[model samples]
Target: MKKGFRFLLKTIMWFMVITFAFVVLFKWVPVPVTPLMVIRYFEQDSEKRTFWKHDWESIDNISKNLQLAVICSEDQNFLNHNGFDIEAIEKAFEYNKKGKRVRGGSTISQQTAKNVFLWPQRSWLRKGLETYFTFLIEVIWSKERIMEVYLNSIEMGKGVYGAEAAAQYWFKKPAARLTQYEAAAIAAVLPSPQRYKASPASPYIQGRKAWIVKQMHFYGPFSYDKK
Candidate 1:
């Protein structure tokens, strides 16, 4: 029992050292690839399944409209929360208990951590690791850095990641040049990017885009300053 306990403790210590180095290293340098990208490459329909468009744009390079749109749609309290949104978590839990339209309350921070470090799984272990990484980034990275990484690293669509790539694919423009409406449309498809089209205007996407535009206005102007 003592030997097993010692081994487990050593493993955890090594994990912490490695993860801390990784998070700090990524704070300045762009992440070249993520676990999700690797996972998607393997879980493909045919050979050369992954067709990635990962242009790592700096936070200032991406449109503020896209940032606002995502904040409005995904996690409004991103600037306020340390890692998790308590009210959203409570609401999601309540909704989940009802067994009706089940919901998730993962903050952008959480999603960033999960997307970069962990595999896409609904397991308790993944959640636990996600919590750890989320806390690490929240503590180590400034709000702007977190927002920068999130905007540049998330899966915008099938084999498509980052704002730069998404903007180019959907609007044939650079991410920095995206208009407010275009940004909102991208945000609208975020809930299920692979399932929804951001262009040629599906009614569902249009409706969600309209709602997101209102939310962008509702949330009002904000900045990603350090808290």
Candidate 2:
């Protein structure tokens, strides 16, 4: 028993050390493959996809509507939270308790961590890794950087990732050119973008878009600028 316990402890320590080393290496080394990128590649059944890589300039550089719409629809307190938003999690827990299916309380940061670094599955082990990566990103990456990575990595559709890809595929325009209504529409389908189309005319899509628009009006004019 003692020998087995010592072996298990050493194995766990080695795993942690290797994981940390890889993370540090990846931070400095730009890899051609990311988890989201791989998923998109598989979804499209093609090897090539366009990714929008933009440096931070102004919110306008990526469409103020997109930024506002996401915050309005997804994370109302994105600017204030430190990686984890306990209040939202508590609310989600309560809401899911009343529902037939379990709901989620993932903030944009948490979503980014899961989408970019982990595989698509729900397990306690995956959740643990997601939490670790979320903490790392929140501590090391700026808020703008987190948003940028999220924008660049989220699955927008069957073969699409990022605002640029979704904007082009859905609206035939660059992400910077997305309109308020279009932005809201895009944000509306985000909960299940892979399964739902962001058509403004669809009843459910329209309703969700309207709700997001209202949220923007309620939460707009507040600066989400964070470091």
Candidate 3:
């Protein structure tokens, strides 16, 4: 019994050490690729499985419009939240319990944690780890760093990832040059990136984009002053 308990405890300690190291490393290093990027590659048809696009642009290089647009559309209280938004989670729980269209009240920090470290799946195990990583990143990385990683890592289209690639693919421009409508269009499709196009906008996307733009205006004069 002593031997078994010692092995389990040592295993857990090693895991914690390794995960903490990675979290601290990412605070200063650009994420080259994410688990989702690899997972999505294999999930596609064999002929197209190799297709992938991602470009890491500094947060300063990505347009402020895209940054604020995502904040308005995905997480209104992103700047204030630690890792989770209790009110949003409660609302999601209530809505899901009612059997309406399922909703996730994940804050930007939570989403960033999942996108960077965890696989894209719905499970209690993944959710638990997601919570763990979210807390780590929130504690270790600044808000600007969090947003920078998010803008540079999320899957924005079928094969495209990050604001830089998404801007070039959808708008034929760099991320730094995206206009407000262009930014909102990209943000609007984030919920279902594979099914939506930022350009040649669908009516549904157009409507969502308009709403996001309005929210961005109400969000008002956004800036991320790195400290």
Candidate 4:
């Protein structure tokens, strides 16, 4: 029993050490494997797709509309929550019970943690890792950093990652100049961007855009600076 306990402790310590190392390394390194980058590599060969890479300083950076739209669509109480929002989780559970796959309680921080560091899958183990990383990022990163990473890493289309890519692809403009409607359209397809095109012409896309616009007004502003 003593030996077994020692082995488990050592294993956990090693895992923590490795995780911390990667976190520090990636903080300085531009991660090469964004969702859209990976998809583009496989879908149409990486050479064909134009992957927009911009740091936070680009004037056409992610607009306030884009940020607010994401908050409104993903987590209304993102500013108030810690790593997890229990009330939103419970509400999501109740909503799902009613035959509606209409809710996810993930805050911007949690979403950024998953998008930047984890893979796409639904498993208890993956979710556990997500929670762990979510906690780590929330503790280590500011709310602005979380929002910036989320905007930069989210999958906007098959070969599109980040606001700049999506903006250029969909609206033929830069990300910083995206209108509320354009931002809403981008945020609306976030749930299944690979499947749903981010254009305003499709009926379902247009309806989703409108719904998100309504939600934006309902949720109001997210003040990350305050909390």
**Number of the top lDDT candidate:** 3
Q: Which stretches of candidate 1 lie over 4 Å from their true place?
A: none
TM-score of each: 0.96, 0.81, 0.97, 0.83
> Residue by residue across 31-141, what tens digits does model 3's lDDT show?
999999999888999985676799899998999999999999999888877888999999999999998688999999999999999999899999999999999999999
What is the alpha-carbon lDDT for the whole of candidate 3?
A: 0.93
**Pairing residues by index, what is the TM-score of model 1?**
0.96
Q: Per-residue lDDT of 70-126 in model 2, one digit per residue for the tens?
A: 888888888899989899999899999899878789999999888867887789999
Q: Write the per-residue lDDT of candidate 1 for residues 1-227, one digit (tens) a residue.
A: 99999999999999999999999999999988888777777788776675678899998899999999999989999988899999999999998999777699999999999988999878999999999999999999888888899888888888788999999999999999999899999888887877887886699888988998999888888966635
- Which one is best on TM-score? 3
Q: For residues 1-227, could you state the per-residue lDDT of candidate 4 as single tens digits?
A: 99999999999999888877766665555555655455445666557765444333232367889988888888777787887889888988888889646677677777777787776766788789889888887777667767777787778876678888788888999889989999999998998887988885479889988988999888776667766
Error of 1 at 134 (Å): 0.6
Candidate 3 vs candidate 4: the TM-score winner is 3
| TM-score of model 2 vs. true structure | 0.81
lDDT of each: 0.90, 0.77, 0.93, 0.77
Error of 1 at 84 (Å): 0.9
Ten contiguous residues minimizing lDDT sum, candidate 3: 218-227
- TM-score (C-alpha, index-matched) for candidate 3: 0.97
RMSD of each: 1.3, 4.0, 1.4, 3.3
What ranges in model 4 sit over 4 Å off? 1-7, 25-29, 35-60, 100-102, 218-222
Q: Model 1 residue 195 lDDT?
A: 84
